[model samples]
Target: MRKNSIKNIRINSEVQKELSNIIRTEVKDPRIHPMTSVVAVEVAPDLKSCKAYISVLGNEKAAEDTLEGLKNAVGYIRRALARSVNLRNTPEITFILDQSIEYGVHMTRLIDDVVGKEEVSDDGMNTEGDEGSC
Candidate 1:
């Protein structure tokens, strides 16, 4: 049952949504940062386990604390999920820090830096060519 079928996709989205809401409204752990967000959710095809990718807007400390908070509240979150969703077996929740967004931003900055340098060199070359012509 490793297929990524339509039903699995739907269940993933539903779990992601419900978890996000539960975290935002129900969970009151101080370690959980206010800027934490559910980036994505991957549910097993058997619906026995789930991995929730979370992103925290602060530094490494915030990310760690948020993850710790989530880990400590896993039982509560699972119960909440069981109550909210109609799944036969509630998936065991695991929170993982997702740095994909931060990595994308860093890559974009590097690309812009390279492009900017190339444009400056091109401009200098054009100026040199014009001077030689004149």
Candidate 2:
């Protein structure tokens, strides 16, 4: 069930912060890129499951390897989480690759290129689409 109560929201917020810290510092997988960061954390109201969104740095191969490494290290992290937090039942953690940041970057570059082309053609310059200017 989704957390509807204020107390549950607070608990989730605290858990997210703690888990973000734990995941950021505790896991030392060589596969993980140095620029990786926790993008989001979602915990069930009952605290049985947690979904972590992580952004990977470098190429696609690096991201895939990092994900595999994170999956393998989940157990160790969960145990550490149980010890660090005062929760009765530690949530099962799952890692997801967060690509929205990369997608946004790609879109931004595309927009910039389009704007640059437009600026270059601003002074009565015509390519294929400008029959009137031609």
Candidate 3:
């Protein structure tokens, strides 16, 4: 058996890409997480399993509900994928809701807050820049 390289990843990745397109264009469910973006796809070397990373753009009850909706529609999506992809076996798809986007937003807000505070202090509010501070 030859070792699988990045090229070997193309087939499964194509499947994932196809699935993304279909979901965006075909899946006509209002609850299918409109803000959801397919972040990445990782297929096992055997091509029997894949974990899809997805990010939802907002933080609210709707976001949570959207993820739940995506979970429920996995089967239909997979079935649709099988129709278009010419493969011996269509890998099982698993959706993992990525919170990295949310984390990034939170981090950005925190940084902005810090910068805002610094600006206020620089206006002679807490300018105790003595030998004790950096």
Candidate 4:
């Protein structure tokens, strides 16, 4: 099967959803932050391997701990995945730390800071003009 085939896309979404549910409800590791989420899932076309992108809303230590927790629980996770989803072969999951969400948030804050500064300068100039006119 092609990488981007309709079947592959469907499988990816299904696996992503199931993995999210499993992590949210089944996993009971303190290291796994409560704000952990599965960002994306890519199951190989051959169904032999999978990459699961995970995003954790916490400090770097929390994220690293979450990854470690997930790695240690990979066996149970795979078994859970196998039971939840029917497939020819249960793919080996590779947990990947995805920082795209955090990056987007940081970029937004920078843009907002720049905009705020511009607004302040604009207001100061306007106030000076108003004082002169008065």
Candidate 5:
């Protein structure tokens, strides 16, 4: 199957959803943060391996711990995936720490700071102009 085929896309989304459910409801590792989420999943065309992008809404230490926790539970996770998703081959899931969400939040904060400063400077300039006009 082609990588971007409709079938592959469907499988990817199904796997992503199932993985999220498994992690959220099944896994009981304390190291895994409660704010952890499966952001994305990529199932290879061969269905032999998969990449699960995980996002943790916490500090770096928390993200590391979550990754470690997921790694340790790979076997159980795979079995769950197989049970939940009737795929020909239950892909070996590789949990990858995805920082895209954190990066986006950081960028949003920076943009907001810049915008706030600009607004303040604009107000100051407007006040100065009004005084000069008076």
Candidate 6:
């Protein structure tokens, strides 16, 4: 089969949805934060394993706890996915913390800071009114 075939894409999406729901409603671990979200999922072509990207809205400790909770509940999640999706072999779910959103925010803040400094310097250097006087 070709890489990332239609069938594989559909399977990945279904698994992502099912796993998100399972994590939200079924898992009762206290370590799992309520603000956790499934960012993305990538299923192998062979359908034997999957990587689930998760985003947690909190500090590093909270992210660690959330990941630990998901790791502990992997079995239950896989079972639920198997039942919800029609597949011969349920892919093994591996939860990975996604920090791209946080990184983007940081980058934006840095850009804004630079722009603010530039604007302040420009304001100080404005001699337009006295340009033709001298």
What value does the lDDT take at residue 17 in candidate 4? 98
lDDT of 3 by residue, 18-128 (tens): 878877887777877776788778777676887888787876676777677777888888888888887777779888888888899899999999999889888664557
Report the Cα lDDT for residue 50, model 5: 100
Q: For model 2, what is the error of residue 119's alpha carbon versus the real structure, in angstroms, after optimal superposition?
A: 1.1
How would you order the candidates by TM-score, starting with the best? 5, 4, 1, 6, 2, 3
Q: Could you give candidate 4's per-residue lDDT for residues 1-134 as a string of tens digits?
A: 99999999999999999999999999999999999999999999999999999999999999999999999999999999999999999999999999999999999999999999999999999999999999
How high is the CA lDDT of each candidate model? Answer: 0.94, 0.82, 0.77, 0.98, 0.97, 0.89
**TM-scores for the candidates:** 0.91, 0.82, 0.78, 0.96, 0.98, 0.88
Kindly provide the TM-score of model 5 when superposed on the true structure, using C-alpha atoms: 0.98
The true-versus-predicted C-alpha distance at residue 123 of model 1, in Å, is 1.6
Best by TM-score: 5
lDDT of 5 by residue, 84-121 (tens): 99999999999999999999999999999999999999
> Residue 80's C-alpha lDDT in candidate 4?
99
- Model 1, span 42-99: residue lDDT tens: 9999898899999998899989999999999999999999999999899999899999
- RMSD (Å) per prediction: 1.5, 4.1, 4.3, 1.0, 0.7, 2.0
Off by over 4 Å in 4: none
What's the lDDT for residue 93 in model 5? 90
Over 1-134, each residue of candidate 2 has an lDDT whose tens digit, in order, gives 45767766776777667767776788888887777777877778888998888898678999998889889999988888888788868999999999999999999999999998888877455454577656
Candidate 5 local accuracy as lDDT?
0.97
Which candidate would rank higher by lDDT, 1 or 2? Answer: 1
lDDT of 1: 0.94
Inter-residue clash pairs, candidate 1? none
Q: Which residue pairs overlap in candidate 4's backbone?
A: none
